[model samples]
Target: MLRLAALDGQVSSWLDLFGPIVFYLIVWGLVFAGTGLFVGVFIPFITGDSLLFAAGILSAGHSGINIWVLAIGVGIAAFLGDQVGFLLGRHYGRPYLDRRTGAWVQRSIRRAEKFYTDLGWWAVVVGRFIPWGRVLVPPIAGIARMDYLKFVAANLVGALVWGVLLTVTGYFAASIPAVKSAAYVIGGAFILGAIIAGILSWRRNRAAV
Candidate 1:
């Protein structure tokens, strides 16, 4: 049985499905796969801005999820995720693109290319803020044969900043009465939506396989 999530609830519907600790772990995994997994190559919507925000808000309470852990873990996952994308770009970028089937992938490819060209190595960091760009820019950077060490440095800085800032912002928001309530509502909605999106992505990938 499932309960409808209340817009004003302090917690999310996902909390009902798992213990507080388990729920946080699930959030962590989703954050990881959303960017790190190859799934995003085909589906870019899996990025974790919403998840990170939601998780941060939840962590501010007695949610059993440490803010430090969430921030650091997500940062590492993001860095590694881009690494996978970059490697794919370096090794099988265009050839794979030629065989790829879908307008979404193509459009993302074009956007990622332009983004990388305009900003060069900076795209790797800037792309972290963009949904599709987060997933696509890394591979494009690799395709262009951007220096590996430079990419790593930029990638590290971007990941840490993104992870820390978003999570901390959410954490502090929980301290406010009006803002906390509103953020909880927003975060719950985003979590539920991300869960649905993740399920759809998994099913889509399986079908493609």
Candidate 2:
């Protein structure tokens, strides 16, 4: 997305043309689609991580934007976006994918399937932090026929965490050093959380048996 943004200085030009509010409305839409929409299957390389981080930096000093509002609004968009993916998948997942024989399409489906198989419900949350992972988890979960209640719980937690963490880090990156490191920490936390959840689940199953 950043690369796409840099083309002919479009992002800069948009900020100049639309100012903050309208510009961010566009950002929220992109984030929603990139992370939560099934059409994201085609545009999986979107620079949402960088986009959110940059938005946070702008929110720090950019008048007319509040970090909390940005975080919550984007989070809600992300959550609803996943709902769309899940619903679509529940109704037409495999058939839809069968129609898509593009190389990227197949590869993305395989990777998303791997994540869903390996992580189960946690994939929905951890995938939010991983690119391509976020794009497909929703539909993947639906195709797997996961419980809707479980999917919603994981989606809400993932979106809120992703929204606040990146936005806040970017806000501080406006003044602080190691903004890059903060991103690493966020990614690490998601992977580690998935691992821990897996371990606990294994233990619980063993105990029940």
Q: Put down candidate 2 lDDT per residue, 10-32, tens digits, no spaces.
A: 54455678987887787788877
Clashing pairs in 2: 1-47
Minimal lDDT window, size 10, model 2: 4-13
Model 1 Cα lDDT, one tens digit per residue, 1-209: 02212221324556666767776566666656655665656534334555566667777875566788877777877788888778888898678555656887788778878767656766777677777778777778888999999999978867876666666666776686566456556545644554455456556767998
In candidate 1 the C-alpha lDDT for residue 12 amounts to 58
**Candidates' lDDT values, in order?**
0.68, 0.75
Cα RMSD, model 2? 3.0
Instruction: Evaluate model 2: give its lDDT.
Output: 0.75
Model number with the top lDDT? 2
